[model samples]
Structure formats: C-alpha cells, structure tokens
Target: MQILDTYLTKAIANNDTRIPWGSLKYLIGEVMYGGQAIDNFDRRVLRTYMNEYMGDFIFDTFQPFYFHHSPDVSYYIPTTQVDAQQQGLPMKEMCLGISR
Candidate 1:
C-alpha cells in the first residue's frame, strides 16, 4: 500500500488533473487485490484523483502513460481474479444473472 500512497502523494504534489474515475476504480480494486496486469490503473487513478481534488493547481495537461513505475520490482499478482471480473458491470451481469 505504500507504493499506492506514494503515487497519490506525487499526484497531489504535481497538481495534475484529468484522471478517469472508471480507471481509478479499477486501480483501487487492483491494488487491494495485488494484480499487475492492469497496474497502470494506479497512475490513471492518481491522475484523475488529483484532477478532481486539485483542478486549479494544474499547470498543463499530461498523459496517463507518462507516469511510469519500475517494472522489475513493482510487478504483483492479485490474490484473486474476482475483482477484475466484476469491475464496470452490475452484480447481475458479473454473476451471469444468477439470483442473489
């Protein structure tokens, strides 16, 4: 979680806006589960979170991919695939329409 906190701090410090909420949700989910497939989700979330939280502080527009982290040591495996699978879809869709 330290890595996530650090990234959030950087985004706050840079005053960058334009992060996507959808992507942010995905990122937080990924982080909590420890998945690396969509690790970029973290950068997307911070960018969006900063933008939403500190819009006026932004100096210039920046792309999401520009914020990169070292791949070698940062890669992580999520505890489960359930989180990624459930993202963006309703519980019904995620569960294939099985009655809850």
Candidate 2:
C-alpha cells in the first residue's frame, strides 16, 4: 500500500497520464470483494485524494472503463484539454496498480 501511495504521488506530481486503470480497478475490486482489505481511513483518504486530483474527469472519463475493468480511460478527455500536445492529460492515461 505504501508503494502504491508513493507511486500515486509521483504519478500525480509528474503529470503522468499513462496510469494502468485496469490494475487500479482490480485492486479496488479486490478490496471490495474481500480478497484484500485496507483500513477504512486509508481507503477513504485515497479515494478522496484521487477524486480531487482527477477532478470531474474521474467520473466523466475514467468511470466507464473503470466500471468495465478496462485500462483505457483517455477517451473521455474533456474537449478543452483534448489536444495531443497537452501535458497532464497524457499522464492521466496511466492507471496505478495495487501491489500485493
């Protein structure tokens, strides 16, 4: 979990948009399915931080693939930020995986 936290922080700091969303979804699913667990506070904090970090994109873009267990969430990019030259948007494509 610490590794996940560190990687998440670095990804956010570097504006890495290539996150492996499938992996993250798997981790969250595991936590939800009783395959793994985290302290409630940790889960809440991570969710809140991620929600804030990604803004509305979390729901508008990522949520669909997230619900489907797919790693591709870049398709939902906001029109204003869709230009290929964008920096942060690229990093947003990368989803973080949870390490066992």
Cα displacement (Å) at residue 30, model 1: 1.4
lDDT of candidate 2?
Answer: 0.51
RMSD of each: 16.1, 13.1
Off by over 4 Å in 1: 18-20, 34-100
Minimum summed lDDT over a 10-residue window in model 1 is located at 60-69
lDDT of 1 by residue, 9-43 (tens): 78778986655444445445556543533567756
Shift in Å, residue 86, candidate 1 = 27
Question: TM-score of each candidate?
Answer: 0.27, 0.26
Window of ten residues with lowest summed lDDT in model 2:
61-70
Model 2, 3-56: lDDT tens per residue? 557757888899988865655654444444434336776666566544544433
lDDT for residue 94 in candidate 1, whole number 0-100:
24
Off by over 4 Å in 2: 31-58, 61-100
